[model samples]
Target: MKHRHILLVGASFSGAVIGRELAEAGHRVTVAEARSHVAGNCHTERDPETGVMVHIYGPHIFHTDDVEVWAYVNRFAQFRPYTNRVKITARGQVFSLPVNLHTINQFFGSTMRPDAARAFIAERSDTSITDPQTFEEQALRFIGRELYETFFKGYTAKQWGRHPHDLPASILKRLPVRFSYDDNYFSHEFQGMPAHGYTALVQTMLDHPNIEVVLNTTIDQAAASGYDHVFYSGPIDAWFGHALGRLAYRTLDFHRFSCEGDYQGCAVMNYADKDIPWTRITEHKHLSPWESHEGSVLYREHPRECGPGDIPYYPIRLVTEKQMLAEYVERAQAVRGITFVGRLGTYRYLDMDVTVREALDTARHYLACLERGTAMPAFTTSPL
Candidate 1:
């Protein structure tokens, strides 16, 4: 097979994987990242002040049931087993998240077993709404008013800068209310953080003789035409200059502080109260329990409406936004020589492991298409 000139726009997880796969297949790959660094939001590095490995963008806990993805990343960087135990401060009391058996028992002052707890929750749950439409209805139907108000209502409002009623029901689909005492945030078979950090893993992925990386460089549509094929991991709407209306997105404002000792007892603490401006507080030192630091660094994560200058963190895929996305997808389908991959490109929230798994699948699909002499897919559902 003849080698092709592949241009990957964005040095994110998807781009890095695609670039590596294409290069290994004897294709000349050029990766251009608008940011100075690789690994997009999963970027992590050692703190200069405290010497603790910190997630510069946000906390990224790698968790997935896909063994293939686990093995693939492990080849690049050693992963340290880390389970996220999140605590929420609500109604002037700290409570374990996921509404586990302990949480239910403590909240109701009952010494009920897992089975009893489940029964108790079922009894307490509001059954008035048969067909749940919005996030508010979904939460109310499952956990009822008190628990929803204390835990989700305020947090959802703050996170999206909108009421829970405005959000779609699908957003609450994965919300777990465990009848057992488990407080683990994720139920994935494999869960951990990269020992050195995500940045190192990405650096390894991009380390190829045939792959050339250009950082702090933005590529426009005109530039993309030069390459044989283009892989875009940026926002799909933005790529087309938002011909359809701009999709709504929620961005975060992080306030960082350095302290002499530990401020929060745990790695993550959720402020569920409506009055609190920030959503959660994350301590960098706690992320790597293997290492200890004399001084600690913390970030107060505040969710805000994404503006023109703000960094887009999460897409607000409401009814209107989804309609707008459909229009953009139509435009994307009409375009050729461009493949959209990753969360931003597909406009969906994704975990670290899922991102890697999807990238791998995308690469394999691309190769299969070339081998069969067929047109490549415009978008990979697994990534979005």
Candidate 2:
């Protein structure tokens, strides 16, 4: 088989994995990242003063049920077991997250078993509405208005910069209200954090003889024509220069500060009250429960509207934005030699494991196409 020149834009998890796979297959792969560093949003590094492995962008806990993805990441870096136990502060009281049995008991001031708690919550729930329409309705129908208002209402509004009523019902699909005492944030089969951090993991993926990395470089549409195959991990809308219309995205602003000692008790503390401007407070030291630090580094995360210059964090896929994305999908179908991969490429919020899994699947698909002498897909998993 003849070797092909593969150009991958964006050195994120998706781009890095695809580049490594293609490179190992005897294809010459070049990765171009607009940012100076790799590992896009999952970037992490140790604090110089405190010696804590800080999540530079935000907290990223790798968790997945896929055995292949878990084994694949372990090959690159050692992962330490870390389970996220988030706490929310509302009305001057701190409570366990995921609306667990402990949360229900504490909130109502009673000791209830799983069965009793389940019945109690059901009785409190508003079942008048048969079909839920929006995020607000879904939350109200499941946990009742009191819990929803105290836990999700203010936080959701602050995070998205809009009322929860405007958001789709699918946004609350992942929300879990447990009847048991389990407080783990994620229920994935495999869950851990990289001991050396995400940057190290990405570095290991890119450390291949056949893979060449060019950071702080932007690849234009014209430049993409030179490569035999193109893997674009950048924003799908930006690829077409927003010809259809720019998809709305929410960006985050972090206020970093160096504290003398421990700041927040936990790694994440959600401010559920509307009085608080910031959404959550994250202390770097608490992220790695196995390690300890003298001084601490903290970040007050504030969600903001994404503009041209701001770093896009979350894509706000509302009703109108989905329509615009459909138009972009139509345009992408006509484009050749390019395969859009990753969260931004698909314009959907994805976890670290899902992103890696998609990239691995994409690589396999590309190999299958090569063997069959078939054209590569312009988009994997419908953008619509």
- In order, candidate lDDTs are 0.88, 0.91
Give the Å error, residue 302, model 2.
0.4
**Per-residue CA lDDT of candidate 2, range 49-85, in tens?**
7799999999999999999999999999999999999
Please, what is the TM-score per model? 0.97, 0.98
Model 1: per-residue lDDT, tens digit, 1-384?
Answer: 778899999998999988998899999999999998999988988889889888888888889999988898888889899998999999888999878888888888889998887787778677998999999999989987878988999998998888999888889888798988899998999999888889999999999999999999988898788788899999888899878867889999889998998897889999998899999999988888878899998899999888876789999887788888888888888888889998889999987777888888888888888889888878868332
- CA lDDT, candidate 2, residue 234: 92
Candidate 2 collision pairs: none
Instruction: Show the lowest summed lDDT stretch of 10 residues, model 1.
Output: 375-384
Candidate 1 matches the true fold with a TM-score of 0.97
Q: In model 1, what are the clashing residue pairs, if there are any?
A: none
